[model samples]
Target: MTTDHIGDVTKAFIDYVDHNALHAVAPENVLIEAFLNATAAEAAEVLAHLEDDDIERHLPRVIVHLIRRLAAAHKNPTPDAVAYEAQNPNLGIANQPSHLRIVKYITDVYTSQIKGDLWSVAERVAADAYTRRVGEDCERLAQIALTNVTAAELEHHIKTNVERWRDHGKRLRRITNHDNAPTNLKAVA
Candidate 1:
């Protein structure tokens, strides 16, 4: 959530790379400036670091490490974390749509519900829980969209929630216009 954590993550990445035998072609090796600046023996240093397997087994390890970091990084961010400075975790959190936000909020709670938090096992349980939540939420939102809010109901709700009332007005108003929307707005439920 904090920019300070980037250095730790960078160190983590470097440590993982240093320990594992990924056949990495360092960025310096790609450019002509690197070739021209370096001595002939510099290439030897590069060769020494690279893992020389025909299969390049370490490549998969690098991918797994990336995924692991991502999973680790996906720790739930608070609303205020992104307010001052825009960064990762923040970007990841900010970009999620409201529909997904509803599902994620519910699923995240379900995941963290039992005995504090277990990241791995929680994900599995949350997956099952999320599926059901999404389905139910989708059906409910669909039903809500179809149903018209009575004028008195809208007025009463607007006192508490003007923005939400406006959104409902927009949704209903669209369906009310025969030229704009083909489907009828009225619903029994």
Candidate 2:
């Protein structure tokens, strides 16, 4: 996964590769002189290992990898740091939200076709796992970010509903795990 040019870490390059893959264009033609600042020969050499079909089949995953590299570069600026981060597919906090968005895009634009095809079981599984991992991370991140917010909302709910609870002793007791007025009222106090 060595990048031939630092431009490989750019969003523009990722988008170009994605678009070309979707349109069934050869990767060799991806870096033509007028495009993305690379010569056609350079692009061909960089992508020599990739057949057009390979690009189409693996483009989503490749995009994710490039994004990871881009994020790493943005954060650390060192090639070693970027390469190390790219090797790990797990999302990091600095770029989690954006990465999640890209993963969603990949699933919508690429995985649907791969999963729908009966011959792509392995690819479907990989895509499903990647999306599932991203989802789990996002859920955990949201919970961490929302803990105080939820508690504040709950406190507001209790304040607004205190009178109704007092009117219905049974409900208040049920909620507070107590039969006495003092214990039940302690919640709002």
Candidate 3:
């Protein structure tokens, strides 16, 4: 599906956090750092080791593992971390795994699908509309994770996204002829 707008909005949200949040100043923040350093190529390299069918099923787990290892290695340097650092010296994490690169790759893949681009227009609109709402919440979570926030608070924050998603559909319907979008979109009118 054509998700170019989706990627554009997603990048906007990330840029907002990177530019405005406390994490922007704190390079030591592992979550943000890993995200900033992650690339599609790294994710592709990890997938090269996996069977095609397993890629989607195991991608999230691989990302989590890479992040956790990143944090672990940063907290306590090890030989494996050194080896990984050699490969991804910019990451400043121990045992830099190619799996780490897959994090951002998830969004890139969304924008690459051509067959269903028309169907995804509403999604892109929704994303563009709600970028700041989502970005602020994410920034808040990242900031609080470094200090204080209850599990219940965290759960509430996460649950709010579901409602926002619903709202996106509603807004798209109100704002545009999303349901009847042309089957084949062209850049020029």
Question: Quick one: best TM-score, which candidate?
Answer: 3
Q: Where does candidate 3 clash, by residue pair?
A: 1-116, 1-117, 2-117, 81-95
lDDT of 2 by residue, 1-189 (tens): 566556666867889779856643222122111111323342232222222222223434444344334433444212233234445556443333343544444334432222222112222233333444445545655565566667666566555455433433333223234222133344664
Taken over the whole model, the C-alpha lDDT of each candidate is 0.33, 0.37, 0.42
Tens digit per residue, CA lDDT, model 1, 12-110: 999986643222222211211121222334322222222221112232222222222333444222212211112233333323334334334223332
Instruction: Score every model by TM-score.
Output: 0.18, 0.17, 0.26
The order of the candidates by TM-score, greatest first, is: 3, 1, 2
Candidate 2: residue 124 lDDT (0-100): 28
| Model 2 residue 111 CA deviation in Å | 17
Tens-place lDDT per residue, model 3, 147-182, is 678888877877787686566556554434432345
Best by lDDT: 3
Worst 10 residues of 2 by lDDT: 27-36
